[model samples]
Target chain A: MAEWVEACAAEDIDEEDVVRFDHAGRTYAIYRSPDDEFFVTDGLCTHEKVHLADGLVMDDIIECPKHNGRFNYKTGEAKGAPVCVNLKTYPARVEDGRVMVELD
Target chain B: MNETLPGMVIIGAGECGARAAFALREEGYAGPVTLIGAERHLPYERPPLSKDALAAEAPGIRTIAEADRFEAADIRLMLSCEVAAIDRAARAVRLGDGTALPYSRLLLATGARPRRLPPAEGSKHCLYLRTHDDAGEIARRLRPDARILIIGGGFIGLELAAAARLRGSAVTVLETQSRLLARAVPANIAEIVQAEHERQGVRVLLNAGILELGERGGAAVFRIDQPGNDAGSGPTEIEADTVIVGIGAVPNVELAEAAGLAVDNGICVDACLRTADRAIFAAGDCCSFPLEIYGGRRVRLEAWRNAQEQGALAARNMLETDEAHASVPWFWSDQYGLTLQIAGLPDEGAAVVRRDLGEGAFILFHLAADGRLVAASGIGPGNAVARDIRLAEMLIARRAAPAADKLAAAETKLKSLLAA
Candidate 1:
């Protein structure tokens, strides 16, 4: 079963920032890139399970708050060292005035 | 097509060498790539050795390029092969087995070796952790209730201490210096790290000298001398199951030095990462390159990021395009669930502005005399300060001078200041 839930209001996350979204019991990091693009990935870093929501979002890359390892927010590809695994990115979209993420 | 391409031989199969090999192919280079490593295993990551490897959590190759990646890229890896000398005149390196591999361009990423304590001051049980094998040996002996005596309070020692504590082992760290990480970090930051270790049940003894190491009653013992402590009026004895020496590393510059290459702390390279001979280039811990950002001061960084960047740049420069390498040097250390990261070189006597994010989260921004951001360190929970460091790195690279008040304000977003 697939579900699309409203994570937050579109304006809730400022540009180049991230917000933590909890759907049911799962956590995801909803990011807003500098170009006003929306992305969502697993909330924690693949390196040490640190929250990616608290990390820095630059362009389309999210620099992990722990170890400064990086991940491409859109595709969830790891960008640098100390991080090997790709992040699990979620399908995100902005509908009307709300940011929604698809969970299956 | 492969035979027509130029031959590129990289000397070390560590992180830097592996990245260089992949980067070469990624950068549109159609070349016969040969990667030679002295270690028997394929190229693996070294940073996790002191962390997970020491704790016996995971005991396998933490690889940068898996065997399949190298195969797909057609990068030939020669393992367990020792290069005896660099025959510059012949444009080749002669291996110990008398195999001479010729190269049009060569990259020396020989890395470094751990500085060992003299035999007289070290016992049979004394061990040093640098390679995967060393980490495995230490992990095997890190049994519960094992008393682990770690010498030196540097990153390796502290990381070992954290792993030992997690394994239910008693860890005692001995530092000859007055404070922990005295050489790497500022005194104020060192205090916090020392406190964190102590809080986590690691006994950190600063300003203690090791007189000798010996075996007694099936356990290793260290005789120490403390300058002012009454407990060490003469010599104090500390016993442990094993003595792990995490002193420091000496750059592996023997081949470069013997080859008559410019050698200081490491193989000297220009800003473009090319050695005295244009055909030969060096990077990683083995090479000292000019830091244009710091006024051409030669620096050899052992950090993973530096090695990866330098190795790629050296390869690029060898490809006929000389792009000046410029990026703020960055490094991060993980100990006791705390992430300590620093970006840029902290200038001497630089003014520091501190911001407390509350709940033991803090970020320190270092500014030079001219008011440009020189460096930034973040010691927050789960590396909440990494963003601050990234912005600081940008500011330093641009030589931007923002108002001091904006830097210290809690509500100010680091990236917003860049708009000006």
Candidate 2:
């Protein structure tokens, strides 16, 4: 059985912005798109493997911060130089107001 | 674009080859594109082989293209096939399996191999990290307590030293020059790296040249000599469980030259990357073309970015875009988490200016003649102030156009320098 972990307070994230949360020995980046939709991906840059939590989030894309490689926040597909690996995206759900992640 | 006449057959499906292919497609040429590789893996960045591959836990490896998606773009990838010979006269190529494929054009992206030691090589302790396999094997051998001796202190030698020390290895960098990265970078910049390496407890011995390579007690030994010191100084020997040679690379121009192309330090290609024959082109580590910054001298560049960019441009030219590939050469190496970026070319006597020389320390070397920004190098990329910085040296035969005009003039020179 997997756990429905409380990741972060939904109100903590500003619109079209991102916030990172730690839970159950795991770290996840929570983002709110310009359209108010929410998504999360593995918090790491595909190039140089830097943590994506520290990367730049721009225009529905998470720039790896290092080498400037990017990935779609929605699909996790890699875009740009230096990184070719598609980012591993994590699915998320929102409660009445708090953001939650299902961890297996 | 009518599949542009004389389709190109590029060998060695790596950064150079893939760039050429993508450039061709992006230029709207529905031509026949054949990308051949001796390795089965899709074209992956190779610079990391000596650095990141050794530190898999650390990241920054980005593949310039989609791995599986290359085929979707109709790139004829002949992977895992050895290129036997290039039949230039017939305008075709032969694989190791004896398959003759004709082409109206050819690109010898047949990248170079690591310059190895003697065939009957003595010790198994010696190493080189030019390929992924080489890096993987070296990575496994890297131990904190291991005594690692790097034969050359060029970028690879110094980079490996940094990585090995990070893993707690007793690292010693042996460079024949009095300063590190002497030929590649200016003496002062080399001194900075040397000081930093020494600060990190890396034993950097400059002007201490290696006489020969041999083994004693399962360890590699480098017979040492310091020039102009004395004759009876006797050869001092240093032993290491592991030794990596970075003496430099020998261009893989045999095939291109044997095919009747003008060969220099690399395959002699023009500004258009066209070889002696218009139908053939060359780029990357195996080719050397004229560099305006180096006083129109032809020199070889083995930088990662140059390989990829040149590959793309070669492909574009092989198609219909007849644009000259004159991008200012830029290269960077990452080690100890410090990003070292160099733009343009610097030769002996080129003036240097230290920008922010602290944690954000980046010194820009301005190689100017009659006050024009002939070459600009720093921890970052080029600066449009090249003409000003370069022009400052004008009185000493280094002055040129005014610095103010280089940028504020609202001219295209700024745009072109920025592109490089």
Candidate 3:
């Protein structure tokens, strides 16, 4: 079963910005890459409990604010040191100026 | 001709050695790689030894690569092996077990060991946090209501103190210096860190002299003297069931030095991490290389980032590609729910501009007289300065002298400055 939830207005997220999307008490970090692509990932860093939405998004990578460890925005793969586990990615798309993510 | 291929041999299978091997494979070097380490456990990260591992958190132990990954990568990992001597003439290293491994290029990643306290012997319950076994022993002693005494006020000691306090252990830190992290951080930063520990119910004693360690009723007792008061004239006592000594580390340069390689405070290597002998190279905490970003001052960093970056860089350099270890030094410490990330070396006489982001969050930029950002440190619970502090590293790299006002202004977007 696919449940698509409208996270936020796509226009609300600026280039290279990340926003926390909360629905039914579950949180996800939706990011707008520098390339203007939208992607959604598990909100918190696996290394620590810090939220990835509060991290720094540069180009296609999101640097965890807690440790400066980075993750690939599109695939949610841990790309740098201090972070070993991969971030779970969700199916995300922009429809009619709104960012929608598919969750199970 | 020797039947074995003349491949790369890396000594000391810590983060640096292990990562160098993996980087070599990733960089398309398919030669026979041999990774040797003194410790019996597979190469694991040392940073967590004082953090999550100490706390007995979800992630029990961490390895840079999985055990099977070595086999998949065709990298031979030799555990519990000690390299006794390096025969530069023969282009081989002799292990303690009397096996000589030949290599075309060698990397000395034999990191560092904990510096033992003076008169280190005779303490029944003293411990040093360095290896997996050490962490396990320390964790076992950190039972609830256990009294733990830490000997130094450095990063490792403080981290252990935080973990102990988390486990309901009574923590007490004794610092011979007047402040915490005296050598590493500035006075203001130390004050904040000390305050955080104190607030967490950890008794911190600064400017206290440790006279001796003795045991009474199955407990370790520390004799101390307090400076600047009558207490200095008399020896006082603090007792604990367990004592952890987090006094710094000493570089394992004996093998390199014995091999007649250039050795100073650490193994001396060039910008390419190549030692005096072109066949040999060194990186990570064990080697001192020129830090061009900081005016070519030779520095050996013990941070996890430095080890991984330098290790990979050294591998590339060994593959005959010239790569300089010029990345700005960066490190972070998580304590009492606070993450302090610092980038670059704050030079002496550098002007510091600070911005308070309310609710105990702030960012500081250290700039030269010409206003070139030299370093930046951010402390906050909510990712306050991590993003912006990286900008400072870039500015430092480019030698960009942005105005101090631009750096201090909360409204200023650091990324925008990158374009300019």
Going through the candidates in order, their DockQ values are 0.55, 0.07, 0.57
Q: Which window of 10 residues has the lowest lDDT sum in candidate 1 chain B?
A: B228-237
Once fitted onto the true fold, the runs of candidate 2 whose alpha carbons sit more than 4 angstroms away are A1-104, B1-7, B56-67, B116-122, B227-235, B292-295, B357-360, B379-420
lDDT of 1 by residue, B46-129 (tens): 988888777674466577767897999899899999999999999888999997888899999999988888843546788898
lDDT against true structure, model 2: 0.70
Q: What CA RMSD would candidate 2 show?
A: 8.1
TM-score of 2: 0.74
Give me the runs in candidate 3 sitting further than 4 Å from their true place.
A46-50, A77-86, A95-97, B1-3, B57-59, B229-235
Top candidate, metric DockQ? 3
Higher-ranked by lDDT: 2 or 3: 3
Better TM-score candidate (2, 3): 3
Ranking by lDDT: 3, 1, 2
lDDT of 2 at B145: 73
For candidate 3, write residues B198-262 as lDDT tens digits: 99999988888888778889898888888844545534899899999999998999999999998
Each prediction's whole-model lDDT (CA): 0.84, 0.70, 0.85
